[model samples]
Target: MRVLHIDTGLEWRGGQRQALTLHKGLLSHNIESLFLGNQAGELHQLCKNNHEEKYAGFAFNGELSLTTHHEIQNIVKEFKPTIIHCHDSHSAKLGSRFHKSCTIFHTRRVSYPIKFLSRYFKYKNIDAHVCVSEDIRNYMKQHFSNTFTIHSCVDIKRFDRVVNKTIFDKNGDINIVYVGAFSNQKGVDVLIKAFSNLAKKYNNIVLHLIGNGELLQPMKTLAKALEIDHNIVFYGARKDVEDFYLNSDYVVCPSVSGEGSSGVIKEGMAAGKIVITSDLTANKELIDDGINGVMFKTGDSNALTMSLTKVINKEIVIDHQKIKEKVSLFDCSNTIEQYITLYKKISNK
Candidate 1:
């Protein structure tokens, strides 16, 4: 069966990583797979670097772009793919426009609710709804059927590299790395407050903030205001997150909202580092209370501070073996197989 993957993103994030992984996996399985995405995106660059005509990258800004729509139409006409896999909301909307020609599968990465009319208009033509987390799947099932849970997986092989500690090297006696966009949804402010409180008790510990967003400056300002800027190192954005993950003692996914199967938790678990995340409904699927991961109240800085304190004091021990075993079940290999099975199941019909 032929598959056309649509992921028009401007950055290299978990969704783009998953799209690239699936595209490569499909090719490895001898499936005729093609990709279309933003011309400037890392995902498109990766595809282009392969020097394959099966991939197409455009200057896609949004679903309203006429050029992007025409390019997708031309690709559809030429590729004649049996399955059209949309990797984000914009791509889903654009892909849905061609529902009559091919089956549309949209993957939702967040668990945020879509209103009834908006949801229907968005998903009415979608043949399948692929959720990156079980929480997202359950939520989508309330609005539509044919929903599936496929965890946002990490390639364990990617973390198998030798960490040189050259970029984003570890700092302080205890290093806790936070890798994600700096935003209110990611709870960067709460993380800063919690880290400041944690700092009051420990001087040798450090909080490494990675990734950049509009809230980055604000978070930095907040850290300085809290008199903890010296302890908190803002690395902005780095491609060598795996090395940071490897060299750190813990990975913190301090998300207060908008999480569907955290990539930080998965990558951290794969690297054998202890993951401390907020106790969101989806995060609970990846973390258990005082088990594989440490969790705190969703938005409570005090709860997060206490959780980190417990982790620091060895009050809650993370079993490396247990984490490895649990995370292996959601490896990229399994994720690709699940998608292939779903594609075959729907394509055959």
Candidate 2:
């Protein structure tokens, strides 16, 4: 069976990454797959390099542009895929134009509430809805039907062959890494504040903020203001994140919002590192507090500081093997099999 994947995200976020993973997995299984993304986006560039003929590009500026719709429609006519999988909001909107012609499957990766109008029409047009988290699926079930919950997965092999290298001075320092966007939703400021407090008591601890966003400068200034700038390393958007993940003592996700099945948590667990994340619904689904990973109160820096102290002092012990085994179930191979089953089911209908 053939599938066409559409993603219009400008940045290479979790959704875009999942789309790429799914596309690669499909090709490995000898399933025909095509990708369409923003021409200027990072995903498009990666797809162009890896799968030139299977990749298509268009310029998208958030809103549903007529030109993009026309281009996608023409491609759909030419490709005639069994399933049109929309990976982001913009692409879902674009895919809505051809719902009547083919099976449109939209993957919801966020936990935000859906508008009544959009749910009744645009989302309703979708043949099957795939949610990255059960929380998202529960939220969307009220307005949509034939929904499936498929957690966002990672290629476990990518973390298996990681070459360990120090990103910071390892002078018996307990290094912690955060691998996501430096934005408000990600709660980078919360992590910085927590680290600032932790640094006062434990001078040997270090925090590595390893992604770029609007709040990068602001978070740096906050670190300086808190007098813990020396304890924090702001690594702005590195392609080689596995090195950082491998060398770190722990991985933290302090997101206050917009997290639907965190890839960081799964990747950290797959790497056999202790992952501490916000105690949100999505996070709680993956972590069994103090077993595989730890959880802190969302947006609470003091709680985060306490959680860090527990790990640093050996007050909390994590089973590295158990964590790795738990995460193995969400590997890209399993995720691809689930999607292929769904694709075949929808195609038959």
Candidate 3:
């Protein structure tokens, strides 16, 4: 089967990563697939020779230009895809205009602004909507009324377990790491505050932040004001995050806003590193609460601090490999096969 995947993005993140992984998996399954996205996008360069691109903007603003729609139709005609999978609402709307021959599926990867009109409009275009987590699915169903939940996945092999069981040497400091963009939604400030408290107790604890964002300077200032600046290491925009996961004792994700499914937590689990995340729907989906990983109340620095302390004191027995294994059920191979099944069913209609 021939498939066309569309992403309305520029900067690479979890959603884009999933799309790329799915593309690669489809290729392995002997399915011909084509990827379309911004020409300058990170995923654009990863596409095969059959892939096409439409660089709408650096950011998707929900606007659909006629020229863009015309280009999509041209690509659709040339590729003759059996199915068109739109990765976001922006691309879904554009694909809706030419939705005749191909079966189209839209993947709702986040709990967003939740605009009433747009939700209704989104319900109108795509044949089926796939959400990355049950929490995201529940949110969409409440607002939009129809959506399917397909848990987000990771490349298990890429996040292979670290062989060296040697204790991570942070010079007697316990290393706490956070991997993601420096955004307010990620609650970097909350993490810094909580870590500051942990620092007051365990002077040998360090916080390592990987990735860059708009909130970097403010978070750094917050760390400085909290007097834990010396205890924190900000490795901005790291490409090699696996090494960070391997060398760290634990990972923290204190998100205050929308999170479909944290790829960071999965990667950490895959790397056999303990994780402490917020009690958000997305995070809860993966953590079995004191089983695989620990979850603290979202936005509660005290709760986050307590959870971190528990993890450090050996009160929590986190089976990082077991936690990692749960995500395999949502692996790219299985997810793509689900899409193929859906496409066949829809096309038969």
Candidate 4:
């Protein structure tokens, strides 16, 4: 099947990663795929190696721009894809124009903000909605009455265990890793405070934060105020995430809002590293509390601290194989096939 994936986001966040994975999956399956987005962004660069044609980045706001309709129409006429699987709301609305001739599947990557009548008007043409988790699926169903739940697939082998674990390497100090943006929704401040508490209990503890955001300096300031500045290391938005996961002993996520089955959680699990995430629906789907990983109350520094202490003290017995097995269900190949199934189903209608 031929598919054209469209997204306007420029940041190299989870959404972009998922999109790239989908593109690659389609290619690996011998299905034609193309990506449309801001031409100058990372998505364009990432698509450089793929043997696929990328259309020019159009000047259109994701939420409100229909000005690029003529250009999109031209591209669709030229490519003639069987399905226009829009990866974001902007692409979905744009794809709505060609819905009569081709299947248009709107992949809802996040929980879109809806304010009364505005939402009522925003979803008039989307044929089907795809959500990453049950929580998000249920949420959309409650609001729109039409949505499908599919777990975000991951590469299981990419992060599987490479070597057997030795003794708790307590001599080099416990390494804590945070792999998300430095944003308010990430609850970075809560992590800083929790790290401070854990540091007081154990002198040889350090936190390595990966990724950057608007609140990077503010979170750094919070660490200093809590007197844990010396124990923190900011790697600032990295592409070599697997290397960091391999080196770290534990991974922590402190997001307080806007999460749907985080890719980071799956990555940490696939890499066989223990995880401590917030008590949110997205996180709960991955962590089985004292089994695969642990959970802490969202935005609660004390709970984060205690969870960290348990991980550091070897209180959580993380089964390496079991954690790795969970990632199998999310194989990108299966995810693409599911999309293909949906595409065929929708197109025939």
Cα RMSD (angstroms) for every candidate in the order listed = 1.7, 1.6, 3.4, 3.2
What is the overall TM-score of model 2 with all chains considered together?
Answer: 0.96
Tell me, by lDDT, which candidate is best: 1
What lDDT would each prediction earn against the true structure? 0.87, 0.86, 0.78, 0.77
Q: lDDT, candidate 1, residue 260?
A: 91
Q: What order do you get sorting by lDDT, best first?
A: 1, 2, 3, 4
lDDT of 1 by residue, 113-140 (tens): 9877768786789999999988998888
Better of 1 and 3 by TM-score: 1
Of 1 and 3, the candidate ranking higher by lDDT: 1
Worst 10 residues of 1 by lDDT: 162-171
Candidate 2 residues lying further than 4 Å off, grouped into runs, are 51-53, 61-63, 162-164, 169-172
lDDT of 4 by residue, 108-224 (tens): 766546567645565666777888988788778877766887778777666555543331223236888888988878888898888888888886787888889999998888888
Off by over 4 Å in 3: 45-62, 143-146, 161-172
Candidate 3 least-lDDT 10 residues: 52-61
- Which candidate would rank higher by TM-score, 2 or 3? 2
Which residue pairs clash in candidate 2?
none
lDDT of 3 by residue, 1-349 (tens): 7878888776778889898777777777778888777666765654534353322222333456666676777888888887788887777887666567777788888877667777667547577778888888887777655477777787767766554444333433688889999987899988998988999899678888888989999998999898888888888876677778877889898899888888887887877777889998778888888888889999999999999988888887777567767767766667778876766776677
| Positional deviation of residue 164's Cα in model 2 after best superposition, in angstroms | 4.1
